[model samples]
Target: MRAADEQDYLDFATARVGALYRSASLLTTGDPHLAEDLVQETLGRMYVHWRHVSVADNPAAYAHTVLVRVFLSHRRRRSSAEQPTGALPEGVATEEDATLRLTLLDALARLGPRDRAVLVLRYWEDRSVEETARALRSSAGAVRTQSSRALGRLRSILGDSLPDLTRS
Candidate 1:
């Protein structure tokens, strides 16, 4: 790659890496190591296709789509069934906030990858149904159905604890 092109890619990667990592973290459901690996792979792929990606309408959005695809692909691999266990270390949040966050992440972890992906894209990333359909390579109806079902599953998993957690 030319120096100018390399610089452009670098600039873009630097700006977008944090957001990609955040999305990856949620997709991985608090697995920081796996999230980091996902982001690295996403960035690596973006680098390989930077020529095409840079000129796209929205490179950041493209990068997020790549991240979600990478996550889903990783989940499809047989070896990915081996998940590491442990809670994410606490951040600067208050204890109540930490508890709520962990409860949500734990509930999210119990979901299937596609369900989790739909929830993250629709609710967390605030993507439109059409955008999520494109990201997940599914129809809008499928995305809508998945989103509704995923929320139902999440509510079931959270059960009564969610309201109690929020209140306390």
Candidate 2:
């Protein structure tokens, strides 16, 4: 790559890495280690495709799409079957409102990978149905259906305690 192109890629990665990590964290159900790995893989892939990706209309969105796809691919691995634990692992920092965050993340961890992906992309990232569909390589109709179903499942998983947890 030319010096200018390499510089652009570096700048782009620096600007977007934090956002990518945040989305990856959500996708991994707050697993920081896995989230870091996902972001690294996503960035590595983006680096490889920077020449093509740099001219895209929204490179940040492209990065996010890559992060989600990397997450889904990771989930599909046979060795990825191990479930995350309910408690945040030791040394992980928590926000001031840790209980509420933990409750929500724990609920998210219970969901299937695709459902989690839909919810994260549709709501957390605030992507439109079409945008999320493109990211997931799914149809818009499927995205809508999955979004509805996933929200319902999240509600079911949270039950009435969501209100109580948030009230604290």
Candidate 3:
């Protein structure tokens, strides 16, 4: 690649890495290590296609789509099973905030992969139904249906605990 192209790719990656990590973390249900790996894989894939992607109308959206696809692909692999842990590692949050975060992540982790993807893309990333459909290769109707079901599942998972958990 030319120097200018390389510079553009570097600048784009630098600007977007944090957002990518945030999305990945949510998709992975707060697993930082897996989130980092997903981000790295997404960035590497983006770098390979920089010439095509850099000039897209919405490169950040493309990056997010790539991250989600990478995450789903990883989950589909045979070796992707996650082992359970009895305790969470230390995090940089107040006790109450940590509890809330853990509660939410636990609920998210229990969701099916496509349901989780719909929630993250629709709610967390704030994408339109059309946009999410395009990213996930589903029809807009499917996206809407999945999103509604996913939110209902999340509500069921949180149940009455949500009110108590959020009390500050």
lDDT of 1 by residue, 1-168 (tens): 779989999999999998998899899888888889999999999999999999999999999999999999998884556375695943589887788889988999888888999998998889999999999999999999999998998889898767554565
Evaluate all candidate structures by whole-model CA lDDT and list the values in order: 0.89, 0.86, 0.88
Give the poorly placed runs of model 1, Cα more than 4 Å off.
Answer: 79-84, 163-168
Better of 1 and 3 by TM-score: 1
Which residue pairs show collisions in model 2? Answer: none
Worst 10 residues of 2 by lDDT: 85-94
| lDDT, model 3 | 0.88
lDDT of 3 by residue, 1-168 (tens): 889999999999999999998898888888778789999999999999999999899999999999999988888883756545444534588887788888988998899878899999999999999999999999999999999999999999999766554575
The per-prediction tally of clashing pairs is 0, 0, 0
Mind giving the per-residue lDDT tens digits that candidate 2 earns over 81-151?
75755536334455645766787888888888899999999888999999999999999999999989888
How does candidate 1 score on lDDT? 0.89
C-alpha root-mean-square deviation, each candidate: 2.2, 2.7, 2.4
TM-score of 2: 0.88
Q: Which candidate leads in TM-score?
A: 1
